[model samples]
Target: MNFADISSDIRHNQIIELLLQNNNLSAAKIAAILNISSRSVEKHLAKLKQDKIIIRQGSKKYGT
Candidate 1:
């Protein structure tokens, strides 16, 4: 369950970089930036969360 496994993934790395640039970026925004679907972004985000690599800070609509 080490994050290092997926951390090396291109999409995962890009997501992390985007978050570092602006922590408030939403999944949809990330998706648009990456030219991927929102669902795909959500899936990646969910896995990141499950791995404890990231955390959702507040409400879904207005949270970072």
Candidate 2:
């Protein structure tokens, strides 16, 4: 894979690991933890959701 693809995969895995540790994290919180932008975190979250890797439990502001 290209470097960018590998990097994205690594970040995706990290995001999953973080979620496993604390499922209540917000996109902003994940962005801060990953040293990435909130927009990027949101994109990652979208991909995870699309792939059925994760699921939202409630409202965006207070979901787990």
Candidate 3:
């Protein structure tokens, strides 16, 4: 499949995968997964939230 044909959200599934890896993740965590800026990840996450493709299980301290 052409990644380019997919929506931005699908492209960021790696971030969601990262979130699954931790069960709960912060902006910083997803940023690390995609190697992108946290600000970009935040935008991706916001879109995902509206799409109901991800859920928050509460926040955790980074490196905690």
Leading candidate by TM-score: 2
Off by over 4 Å in 1: 1-8
Q: Write the per-residue lDDT of candidate 1 for residues 8-56, one digit (tens) a residue.
A: 4778889989999999998889999999999989888988899999999
Q: Global lDDT for candidate 1?
A: 0.88
**lDDT score for residue 41 of model 1:** 90
Per residue, candidate 2 scores C-alpha lDDT tens digits across 16-45 of 999999998889999999999999999998
**Candidate with better lDDT, 1 vs 3:** 1
Candidate 3 segments exceeding 4 Å error: 1-7, 58-64
Evaluate all candidate structures by whole-model CA lDDT and list the values in order: 0.88, 0.93, 0.72
For residue 60, give model 3's deviation from the true position in Å: 10
Estimated TM-score for each candidate: 0.81, 0.90, 0.66
lDDT comparing candidate 3 with the true structure: 0.72
Ranking by TM-score: 2, 1, 3
Candidate 1 has its poorest 10 consecutive residues by lDDT at 1-10
- What is the alpha-carbon lDDT for the whole of candidate 2? 0.93
Report the C-alpha displacement of residue 49, candidate 2, in angstroms: 0.7
What local lDDT score does residue 51 receive in model 1, on the 0 to 100 scale?
Answer: 90
- lDDT preference between candidates 2 and 3, better one: 2
Model 3, 33-53: lDDT tens digits are 678899988888778878888
